[model samples]
Target: MQAIGLIETRGLTPALEALDAMCKAANVRMAGFKRVGSGLITVIVEGDVAAVTAAVDAGIAAYPKTGGQLVSSNVIPRPHADLARMLL
Candidate 1:
C-alpha cells in the first residue's frame, strides 16, 4: 500500500462515523475494521500519502461529534509491503 491510516475509537458509532468521514474526505479505501475488545474499534484505510493523512485527520475530526472516545489515530506513508499482506 502507498499509505495506511488507522483510527481507533471507544465505541462502534464513532468508529463507523470516522470511517465514513475518512473515506469521504480523501481518495482512500476502507481496507478493514477490527474490534480490539473492551468496546474499542479501529478503522483502517489505504491510499496515497497525502490522501491517507487527510483521511486520518478527517476521521479524528468526526470523532467529537460522535460523543464517543477517540482512542488513537495514525498514518503510515509508504508502509512495508508485508504490512499489506498482514493487515489488508
Candidate 2:
C-alpha cells in the first residue's frame, strides 16, 4: 500500500460509521480493525496516498454523526515496509 489511514473511535458504532464513510468517499480498501478494550476501536484502510488522505478526512467528518468520540485519525504516506507488513 502506498498509504494507510487509521480512524480510532471510542465505540464500535462510530468506527463502523467512519469505515463506511472512508470506503464510500475514496478508492480505499479495508485492511482490518482492532478493538483495544474500553470500547475503543480502530479502523484501518489502505490505498494510494491521495485516496487514503481523502478517506481519512471523510471518516473524521462522519465520526461525530454517530455520537461517538473520535480518539484520533492519521494517514501515513510511504510507510516503511516493515510497518506495512506488521499492519497488514
Candidate 3:
C-alpha cells in the first residue's frame, strides 16, 4: 500500500460515518477495522498517499456530526513494508 489512513472514534456510529465519508471523499479502499473495548472503534483505509490523506481528513470532518467523540486519526505515507503487511 502506498498509504494508510486511520480514524478512531468513541462509538460505532461515528466510525461508520467516518468510513462512509472517507470512501466518498477519495479513492481509498477499506482495509479493516478494530474495536478496542470501551466503545472505541477504528476504521482503516488504504490508497495512494494523497488519497489516504484526503480520506482521513474527510473522515475527521464527518465524524463529529454524529455527536460522537473522535479519539485520534493518522495517515502514514509510504509505510514500511512490514507495517503495511501487518496492517493491510
Candidate 4:
C-alpha cells in the first residue's frame, strides 16, 4: 500500500480505458485523476509496489486498444505520505 501508479494519456477515452485496465489487472484502487489541460489526462491508482507495477503495465499496454497514445506511465514505489493527501 505504498505505491502510486500513474498513466498519462492524450485524451479522456484513453485515460478511462487505462484506469479500467489497471484496476482489473491488479489489487489497486483509483486514487484520483488530473486533467492537465490541452487534452492531457492522468489517471492515478494506489496499491502495493508489485500491484502498482502490474497495474501501470496493464494500463500502458491497453493504450493501443484505447486508440489513444500514452503520454507516460510511472510507478512511485515509495511515494511521500503528503502526496497521498493531494491525490484525492
Which candidate ranks first by TM-score, i.e. highest?
A: 2
Clashing pairs in 4: none
Candidate 2, TM-score vs. the true structure?
A: 0.96
What is the C-alpha lDDT profile of model 1 across 5-40, one tens digit per residue?
999999999999999999899999999988999999
Single out the weakest 10-residue window by summed lDDT for candidate 3: 79-88
19: Cα error in model 4, Å: 0.6
Error of 3 at 19 (Å): 0.2
What's the CA RMSD for each of the models? Answer: 0.8, 0.7, 0.9, 1.1
- Once fitted onto the true fold, the runs of candidate 3 whose alpha carbons sit more than 4 angstroms away are none
Each candidate's number of clashing pairs is: 0, 0, 0, 0
* Model 4 weakest lDDT span, ten residues long: 79-88
TM-score of each model, in listed order: 0.95, 0.96, 0.95, 0.93
lDDT of 1 at 54: 97
> Candidate 2: worst 10 consecutive residues by lDDT?
60-69
Which parts of model 4 have CA positions greater than 4 angstroms off? none
Residue 55 error, candidate 1, Å: 0.6
Error of 1 at 62 (Å): 1.1
Model 2 pairs whose backbones collide: none
**Deviation in Å, model 1, residue 58 alpha carbon:** 0.7
Best by lDDT: 2
Cα lDDT, model 4, residue 59: 88
Predictions in order: lDDT: 0.92, 0.94, 0.93, 0.90
lDDT for 41 in candidate 2 is 94
